[model samples]
Target: MNSQDETQIAVLRNLYAKQAHLIDTGQHEGWAQTFTADGEFHSPTYGEPAIGHDQLADISRRFSESAQQAGERHRHVIENIWVTECDGSSAQVRAYVMIVGTDIERKQARILRIVTNIDQLEKSADGWLIRHRKVEY
Candidate 1:
């Protein structure tokens, strides 16, 4: 691809990394901010799609609490990110994510789930943000 395409891919990859880190570290607000104000997240695992910032943050908070209570630490590993479509102002991307969990006391890490993420992204003044995302097994 062209240099511009490479740069865009790098930026998108960085965004994914930031999102992963924010949620893993229990930065609920920061993780929700990775999406647009009206962003939507749909996943079978969540039962219902979280719409808007409040719901997004709530989901993240719940996830954090559940992990904490279980004495486990979770990490999201994003891989095989592909810019399936891009037109400067918007893009469609796909990625594979592996959710790894570690037992805090035992210090044992294991893969919990592997999911595919299909995302619709928009470029805004602030940068590229996820407009909608669908996660599936």
Candidate 2:
């Protein structure tokens, strides 16, 4: 790969890593920002789907609030990033994800989620961000 290709790849990776860290840090707003204005989070665990920025923010807010109440620690690991397109302006990213939530009171650790996301992204002046993410179990 050339230098420019390598740079675009790095930028995409940063987007994934940033959201993962934000999730662990309980920064749901930051997480929502990683998505486009019309981004969607399609997780069956939540029952109702969140579509659009404000809805996504509210949904994530509730999730974050619940996590805070539970006082559990979380870690979201993203791996196997496969970039189908990386021209910089837009790209497709596929990644494996495993989220673990450990209950402090129970002192237990368990796998929370094992899944993958086929993410459609757009590159803006600010950076690369997810335009849409189709999540599959």
Candidate 3:
């Protein structure tokens, strides 16, 4: 890989890290900003795909609120991330996600779900933004 390619991969990896931290800390709005304006998040866990930043924010907020109400702590562990393909303007990436959750009553955290994320990212004026993210079991 060329230096530019490596840099792009690094950026995408950082993006994943930022996304995990933002969602884990209940920063839904900030997390939403990681996507493009018309970005989409598709997850079987969510029932339907969340389209656009507005919908993404709503879904994220719902998840955050639900977790808060249940006194649940969630940690999104992203690993085995790889950039499968990259053009100058776009890339395809994949990663494994393991969600660990702990209830307030229980001090121990346990694995809740494991899935793989397939993502399409595009280079935007601001920076690289996620155009579509599909989560699969």
lDDT of 2 by residue, 8-104 (tens): 8887888889988886776778888888878777777677768787777776677667666877777778999988888768999999988787888
In angstroms, how far off is 97's CA in candidate 2? 0.8
Better of 1 and 3 by lDDT: 1
Off by over 4 Å in 2: 69-71
Greater TM-score among 1 and 2 belongs to: 1
Q: Candidate 3: where are CA atoms >4 Å away? A: none
TM-score of candidate 3 against the unseen true structure: 0.94
Q: Write the per-residue lDDT of candidate 1 for residues 19-134, one digit (tens) a residue.
A: 99999999999999999999999999889999999999998998898789879998899999999988888999999999888999999998989999999999999999999999
Considering every candidate listed, which one attains the maximal lDDT?
Answer: 1
Q: Which residue pairs in candidate 3 have backbone atoms (N, alpha carbon, C) closer than 3 angstroms, thus clashing?
A: none
Tens digit per residue, CA lDDT, model 3, 1-60? 899898988988999999999988878888998999999999998888999888898878
What is the descending TM-score order? 1, 3, 2
User: Which of candidates 1 and 3 reaches a greater TM-score?
Assistant: 1
Instruction: Let me know the TM-score candidate 1 reaches against the reference structure.
Output: 0.97
lDDT of 3 at 64: 81
TM per candidate comes to 0.97, 0.87, 0.94
What is residue 1's positional error in candidate 1, in angstroms?
2.0
Best by TM-score: 1
* Ordered list by lDDT, greatest first: 1, 3, 2
